[model samples]
Target: MENEMRSANTEPLHKPLGSSRTFPHFEGLLFSPVQLVKKSLADDVPVDIETKIGPHARRPLKLSMPIMISAMGYGVALSKSFSIALARGTAMAGTAFNTGQGPVLKEHRDNAKFMVVQYHGAFWRPTVHQLGQADMIEIRLGQGANAGAGTVVKVTDLPPDVLADFLATTHEMVDKPLKELVVPPGIPEIRTQSDLRQLIHHLRLAGHGVPIAVKLAASNYLETEMEMALRAGADVIVIDGAQAGTHGSPAILVDDFGLPTLAALCRADDYLRLNRRRDHVSLVVSGRIRTPGDMLKALALGADAVYIASAALFATAHKQVLKPLPFEPPTQIAWVNGTHASDFSIDEGADSLARFLTSSSEELKSGIRALGKRSLREVDRSDLVAWDSEVARITGLPLV
Candidate 1:
């Protein structure tokens, strides 16, 4: 009788699956808005969003604004055209563009004013000359999506020329579809803190005085990790939170790994302050930072700057995505080897992205002024108050 009653409560096997449950995201938290006195009375006065990263270094990296284009590799994640367009757009906006693990394209390097080259764990590491060309070097320890897991890509999926290049660089060949594939994972040499220190020393020399940054996924021991990175001589620390997106990461890794952006940012900040290195090493945060309000909130919470990837891609694709729509996801237009990849216009995409950055900076400046602050640096944690109890606790900010 109990079994019969339980069976009656179960849904039919033939019923279609419902929408997947929503995951916790940065959007769940709300930022306290500026409501009282204005910071700038002169509407003509432009807010100085210019920020200097790695100030203690011989050659510090500077930006016109606090926002930058995050790492998104060419061939692996996006096409050459998309990479070039983003580089051009970021250059126009006076911001930096990061070249992810994939081999760097000359077009992107030529177009971007400030290029941050990523040294990944993959076999596709760049040559010393290539590394020297970058304005900044980021040693990628891990990412928010698929933190420690390896990622595989089939050779057949790549174009003929791209496949040949990858083969030559990695000295790898495909015997069969499933048996042989391109896989990238954590750097084998960096199993200990001592190894990380050696890598930082090598990169510092290879980068030709350019700032060397260490990128790590936000996890429970992020503070401890940051300490090691700083001790290893990293000029900047990039914390990628759970809300961060990836082009082709596994669903399980994306959904289940890393700490949220709020928690990660607060913990890193607290650690830096405790060590009296708050002003020594710059902290850059990346996750699901969508709106200008989100960027402002992150900056106020102690982030020196913000790294934007998915948002930049969307801005670059802009109206171009419409061309591929009704048939595929918008990213299909941006992805390498996508059916519509060739259809994307670099000129149009670059223009759209530049406008997006400019407008977003303006909005952020408005928010800064609303808080009675003249500069982005003036907008600190004191100006912020969280509406959600969980967010308040996670960020260590006051509750509204």
Candidate 2:
């Protein structure tokens, strides 16, 4: 009876999942600029910085900054130049980059100081040897948007090797009877969370390698899911909210089904406390972590660092406007194979990131000061005042 009841409760997740709802009808909450400033001034208190995740893991990873870039899979979200520019930005910010759900670009490995590589699908393969190179490898169960859904990448979105693999998989899967085969439009692999976990365990067992991570979309049973992930040997966990950006999938999937980042992070933090193993794993939060304040709030709530990507893409694209006349996003193909350049000669892009990181860090420190704190580690969940929802729910902010 208990098993039956649990199964009944889990069914809603099978529905076509969409953007996060931890703060339901979130769009209704945003207002004009002046109100933003006025509301920003309302908070008052000293931030309580705390170590929300395991001290051993956090110390080794050393993720101190609140904002880290969410990995948008290569091709769909960024080109080589775009990624390199983002790497430059992350370096400026003293943060890490979550490698999007694609093969780890060697250039990205060299360009970024810290990274989390996510294994997205079967066709997106990386050998254990490849896994050894990562600071951490994240096995993605589902991103918030298009949960239970996978993407179809245009040839343009895939690099040569990924393209070859996708074509081979598609061809192999195509011969099967329609009843026995199901493939997503843009992605060639059919991934289940169970499959992801199996792979995660293998990576964790690889001696001396960085820890293995698993990324999941938040659902009502998130606590259970997290516990299971921990049990499955995940050293780090990423709770990507439905509000997280995706280049593919129906618009409906983008707006419904999953929890928002704010709520998901809060729930994951709570889950850690419940299991008494919050200290055993590192918690990284992604899904619209655009600013330092977002990172600060998440860290105080329990996340170690925020993942980012979209913002850096825009930054790089805009800066590219000043590149050599008639700039097209550059490509790197190997000798006689069209290898693209990773060299970022344009100081504009790198300089922009440097300035943005410095300014944002300062702004974060100001928020800290208002709350009567010093370092980022000092900020805590209590330092925030949720004006929107009541105590029982994600607070709806008072539109200033």
Task: For each candidate, give its TM-score against the true structure.
Answer: 0.90, 0.70
lDDT tens string, model 2, 1-400?
3356547774322222133444542332322222333333334433333222323432245543556666655544444555565666667666666666544567677777766666655444455555666666677777777665765444553556544433432323444322211223322332444654576657665424466777787777788788777876677888888677664455556766677777787778887878798767888877766666665666667777666654554454444433432444332211111233333443456567656666766666666666544556655555554435542266423332
TM-score of 2: 0.70
User: For candidate 2, what is the lDDT?
Assistant: 0.57
Candidate 2: 10-residue stretch with minimal lDDT: 329-338
**What TM-score would you give candidate 1 relative to the actual structure?**
0.90
lDDT (10s digit) by residue, model 1, range 1-400: 4356447776322111111224334444555445454434355666788999998877899999999998888877788888999999999999999998778767878999999998876666677778888899998878877576655666667787766655555433445543234445667778888898899889889888888999998899897888888888999999998878776675556766788777888889989999899989999999888789889888988999999988888999999999888998788899887889999999999899999999999998888776666788877887776666777677776767
Candidate 2 off by > 4 Å: 1-59, 156-198, 321-347, 390-392, 395-400
Off by over 4 Å in 1: 1-40, 167-183
Number of the top candidate by lDDT? 1
Angstrom error at residue 90, model 1: 0.5
